[model samples]
Target: MASILMLTAATRRERNDATSFVFDAINACGGWIEDVHMYSNKMTTVRLALPGTAIEDLIGSLIDGGIAVDPPEAPASSDDRERRVTLQLTFLHDEPDLMRDIPAIPG
Candidate 1:
């Protein structure tokens, strides 16, 4: 069965290069991209379709390529028919925790 996979990634490299790298990894695993959205020059989100069983292989390939991806999260709904997966990829030293620099307000 085919499933929809959404992946978000942030990189310091040029947007085109990052997109190509992601597309290459997905294509290497036999997956095809359906849609792509760029939130910023450094961030992109891609929607793709692939066999439900091949998700693991795709993640493995990305990790092997030196991209750090967060663990896939289960669908928020409890419905058993949901077949979508979302993953976030972070390029080493590219994404910083800006919130850490924000000071907390007095309670």
Candidate 2:
């Protein structure tokens, strides 16, 4: 099983329950609560590690919850066979498992 990385947050301060609840759910689903790194702007980022989990599956669920994913940009290539795909992700809510803290928020 490959190590799956993910980001989870309530996004709204009013939804503390939502965030806490989601964290609990993740733990129940065999997710490891790694670390939480809050931004200076007050955006709290939590990190969780899950063993034997698929990042795609977690990403799908986040999508279902209105999550947005912003994947890394593809590097430029001169080869004809070389191609790059960019994926951006976001979330309407945190997943049951696989919450990760993003110290440096992606642009």
Candidate 3:
């Protein structure tokens, strides 16, 4: 299913890494990015509609890229049925591996 990722960059130190992760991960995820978004805090939120159910490769890519991921969170309400996962993350741009990924926000 298609979903949105609210990747909170949190601090300046995380921007480059997070940005790199976003770019790489989106590419690895097969160009599913419908929209690319950013905030004053250096946070980037992506709207993606992946073609497959297997997110492991994508997740792994992010992790390997030096991104730290939080456990996936379940949607909070019936109104949120469209969104199944939320990931909290912190990534290191220099590493560039999926294992270094962090998951944040409503996916």
Q: Which candidate is the best by TM-score?
A: 1
How do the residues 10-72 of candidate 1 rate in per-residue lDDT, one tens digit apiece?
A: 445544665677789777766677766554444556777655656777777766655666666
On a 0 to 1 TM-score scale, where does candidate 3 land against the true structure?
0.50
Backbone steric clashes in candidate 2, count: 18
Per-residue lDDT over 1-107 for candidate 3, one digit per residue giving the tens place of the 0 to 100 score = 44443333232346765676666776665545566555443345566544344355556666666565543333222232233223334333353443434678796
- Model 2, 1-107: lDDT tens digits are 22233343333332354345446644554555666544333345556654333334444444444444443232223223312121211233343534568799788
Candidate 1 regions exceeding 4 Å error are 1-14, 75-107
Model 3 residue 81 CA deviation in Å: 17
In model 2, where do residues sit more than 4 Å from their true spots? Answer: 1-18, 21-25, 40-42, 72-107
Winner by TM-score between candidate 3 and candidate 1: 1
Alpha-carbon local distance difference test for all models: 0.58, 0.41, 0.48
Which one is best on lDDT? Answer: 1
Report model 2's TM-score to 2 decimal places.
Answer: 0.41
Error of 1 at 36 (Å): 0.3
Ranking by TM-score: 1, 3, 2
Give the worst 10-residue stretch by lDDT in candidate 2.
Answer: 82-91
Task: Kindly give the stretch of ten consecutive residues in candidate 1 with the minimal lDDT sum.
Answer: 74-83
Clashes of 3: 31
Q: Estimate each model's TM-score.
A: 0.59, 0.41, 0.50
